[model samples]
Target: MGGTSSELRDLTNRLYERAEAYGMEVKTGKSKIMVSSTTNTSADITMNGEKLEELTKY
Candidate 1:
């Protein structure tokens, strides 16, 4: 996991791209982000340019 939102966002985007290249689809509606840190910063994560939902303690 990343130490910050931006880092995680970049990582997530790359993952989505790589997955698509392999004919894999990331179902954003069912996807979630779980941050392990104490920080309250939110990551604007997206797949196919759609924002992903964030979850706490999941």
Candidate 2:
């Protein structure tokens, strides 16, 4: 999903909501967001009231 930050955040939020409905949850502490581009593409993608960390490189 390589799109604008807002798009990604929206997709993430929808995903989290669907997962929650199925009795599943994303462990935010072990979750991360990675952008393929070199430029910054960060957005407030929160799950379970916690913002996910961004992975700079990996």
Candidate 3:
């Protein structure tokens, strides 16, 4: 699915929330954002208020 950066961030936040509820944690450094679109827009997703690094290819 495709969405704006804000939507992506929200999704990430929700994921973190669910993970927390289950006593799990997100490995932010191991996480990445893959942009399939060629829009040149930056993927500024954050988990626990910290920005996640974006990868050109995973």
Tens digits of lDDT, candidate 2, 1-58:
6487788888888888899999998788998888666665455667768989876542
Q: List the residue pairs that clash in candidate 2.
A: none
TM-score, structure 2 vs. true: 0.76
Winner by TM-score between candidate 3 and candidate 1: 3
TM-score (all chains, Cα) for each model: 0.78, 0.76, 0.80
**Model 1 global lDDT (CA atoms, 0 to 1):** 0.81
> Compared with the true structure, what per-residue lDDT tens digits does model 3 show for residues 1-58?
3377777877888889999999998899888887666656677677776788886532
Candidate 3: regions farther than 4 A off: none
Q: Candidate 2 regions off by >4 Å?
A: none
Q: How many residue pairs collide in each prediction?
A: 0, 0, 0
- Candidate 1, RMSD to the unseen true structure: 2.1
* Residue-by-residue lDDT tens digits, candidate 1, 1-58: 7877888888898999899999999898898888664656566778777888987552
Worst 10 residues of 1 by lDDT: 35-44
RMSD of each: 2.1, 2.2, 2.3
Per-residue lDDT for 35 in model 1? 62
